[model samples]
Target: MSVSKLAQERLGDYILKYCLLFEINIFYFTFHTTELRSKHSTKYFLLCCFQTCFHALCRKFPPSVNYRKRFLTELIRRQETVDHAPLDELYDALADVVGAEEKSECYKSYLLPCGDTVSLLENVALISEGTTGLVTWEAALYLAEWALDHQQVFTGRTILELGSGVGFTGITICRSCSPKKFIFSDCHTTVLEKLRDNVQLNGLTEKMSPAVSVEELDWMTVTKEQIKEMEVNTVIAADVVYHPDIVESLVKLLSKILSGSAEGAPKILICSTIRNSETYSGFKQQLEAAGISHHVITGPVRKVFPYNRDSFIEMITLYK
Candidate 1:
């Protein structure tokens, strides 16, 4: 049984589970391969495939991988179960699995540590925190990759990421972007803690990596004190504009973060892929009406051969 074969067998189910919330292509990337015992051919093949998926979505002169999304449009046919549970436990358990499974480090040793609930990587109902977190329908990794490709926006700047799922994008910047600092903010303290553990699992900390912080930031009710407490100068969010109802409140939070800054000015960079025309149109209008116009930059996302249906990010820059 080759590792690739083993991985492929599970990839379909994983894709289906992820597709329940996002486009299935979002979960089809290569899992971690940093310290695989597999041969170079297998390892390199996995890496190339991942790059292809990323590049295809980022619009980087298309690669050679031709993948599609509708293959799973009818695949993830499960209704999202909204069982009530503490979010911290969910984030901790899920983050442990994701961080350990991450190619960055700690795989094989961390297999969804807390065996209490549904996989945080898949289950949505278990995520508990201060204010409710609306489902943001997009891959957080692609957003991180897009932001990394544009290091100039984050280079030497204090950056903050809200609703950082598995802390992939913020962690990506800690590893790839030349930011002075990176803060991974989430509503659930459990997610924040797992994000912290992930940073460590990857051997990243103040001692070994760039400056990073994780905090509880319920966007809807964030106070002036909370905004002032953060030292961030730029904010980045991925696929966070899905729900039209929360756009105004979320933008207001970003506005508050930007409003209190003394240094030149703060920018809120939101990345999304057009999931639905109605949501995209309304979110854009909401941002503009609040005096925060949006800037769209097509990122060079993938290196693989991309199909028209590859997962990608929509880079949005906001300013008053």
Candidate 2:
């Protein structure tokens, strides 16, 4: 049976989202007979899904073994509902995962709209090594979507990212937006180490155009000289406004970077998840007190990465 255009689109989306390890509930696999006529069509769809996910598991930078096991288990559980036995390949993949030792690190790959993939080696835990920078945050995904939509802002421009955890947004911009230079900055030792590995994993080393570099930048201790030396035309950050204390230092850092620029102040774009209302409000107030003007900018037109859609994330633009 031929699948409708809508069904084909939905199947493609499901397959890509699964490969990226997006949160797939059991309900997603509950296929209706009316929608897909004939057992053959249903089986074809299931095979396509499993093959894409299996390829992701065997990729050079694969997801964690635990994650792969969970995915395979879900697919196997759905096989009974379809009145069909699980594919032998699916069982084999699960066996491999079960036999392998689990690691603290894993890889998450995002397929960009430009047909390029941004893969990063990230910590499996939400917070690791006394810092949350070891993994990509929701706000980083939000900001990356926005940047891809506004490619002109970064194209041919030198960009500096503050608190660039795991280098997701920066790498995405460098690959898709065609930035002249991309610098990823963070203070945590473990975060920086993993960030550099991710950059190389994505093949964004210095040898490539839009020269990519990782720097250790502590917002509290960063100086005007340091910001000036970077000579960036644009400054961006994501998920760096979690605490009230950091608000003061971030505002000061933005002020220094803007003032020290020779070819006029570099544009500042900051994206943050509104986990705490008071903390977010304090960020804006600090920007005002420091003579920096900020306005809430529009979000991305579409999402290219998987993230918590329910979370409230805001993107703001700062200027002198």
Question: Whose TM-score is greatest here?
Answer: 2
Model 2's C-alpha root-mean-square deviation from the true structure amounts to: 2.6
Off by over 4 Å in 1: 1-138, 301-312
Q: Report, for every candidate in turn, its global Cα lDDT versus the true structure.
A: 0.53, 0.81
- Tens-place lDDT per residue, model 2, 11-127, is 665666544354344345454445544565555545555545555443666777776777678766665556465577667767877888989988777788877777788888998
How many Å off is the CA of 169 in candidate 2? 0.4
The TM-score values for the models, in the order shown, are: 0.57, 0.90
Candidate 1 — number of clashing residue pairs? 16
Error of 2 at 304 (Å): 1.7
Off by more than 4 A, model 2: 1-13, 23-37, 41-46, 56-58
**Local accuracy of candidate 1 as per-residue lDDT tens digits, 7-64:** 6545433432232222234435433443233443343333333432232332322111
